[model samples]
Target: MLAIVLSAPVVLSDLYARRVPNAWLAATLLTAVAATLLQRLLGATPVVWPSLPGLVTGLVTMLPFYAIRWMGAGDVKFLATLGFLLGVRALLPIWIIGCLMTGVHAVCMLLFRLPRIAYAPGVSTVRQHLHASPLWQRSLHARQGRVGLPHAAYLGIAAIVTVLTPDLMHWEGA
Candidate 1:
């Protein structure tokens, strides 16, 4: 359930923001539920497919990030679903990689003149600016800039590592 917990924020953010594709979330959730039930009925060693609910949840959660221009909708769903399928144990590395990717993207945004605010230490000034600006105005003023790498690609790599090295989650004895 680690994956589910970790991915919850991303999926919920997406869903709250309405940035995710409904069909995709629905399909993933359905698949996961079915797979989990099957695994229990058949007495499988581990059930992986039911983890898709986490993925769906992640996708839905990512809508906020997407709306805020923090991440793409696809990235949110992909990582969340990946976490669910892999489980909490498999999510450690994925989170590490995702964080790294997010950092890199942030740095690139800073370098590339994306719609970001200049750093100001004064809380009063920041508050004043926020109050003066319209809700969507801030997003509008922020330029649509490019972050070289796609987050999904990084997530894919993380998923591969987690799947191949399941021991990372320390489930060896369990």
Candidate 2:
């Protein structure tokens, strides 16, 4: 519930503006930390504490991508927030799945643009009629080959996937 509340606005921002808002990230981080502390105060064994190491690992792991200009600062921060939400134990798997999903998304974007690349660069195709409107339609149509994934959006999807397929990610205790 908290995850949905915190992430929805960030997702919307990423989809619409190609950016994540700092305010959203800060709120999410604070909420996560507060939740961890509150759980500890209630003697709930502090599941969030064990996950704390994920914050470091997640940030460190993603730093290279951001350094290379493959990812934005906001995206990196968003991923670290996900690390905190998922915890240390679930961090690696979640990150891996996110990466996989990103790859799939990239491939899809490429595939989507292939027809445009091959034939009418400026013309829309009958295929567009067959396919439902995709999330990145505005950016993809406007920019052509220069299109890039609003990668932060994929992280949100990865988080949802983690929740849905917890068994696959070995999220038993986490």
Candidate whose TM-score is highest: 2
21-111 per-residue lDDT for model 2 (tens digits): 7888777778777887889899887654335567777788889998998888877888777777776655666667667877987887677
Q: Give the TM-score of candidate 2.
A: 0.71
Cα distance off (Å), candidate 1, residue 114: 16
Q: Model 2, which residues run further than 4 Å from truth?
A: 42-44, 112-123, 126-147, 171-174
Which 10-residue window in model 2 sums to the lowest lDDT? 139-148
* TM-score, every prediction: 0.47, 0.71
What lDDT score goes with residue 32 in model 2?
71
Candidate 1: list runs displaced more than 4 Å: 1-29, 41-49, 52-64, 101-148, 171-174
Candidates' lDDT values, in order? Answer: 0.57, 0.69
State in Å the error of residue 149, model 1: 3.2
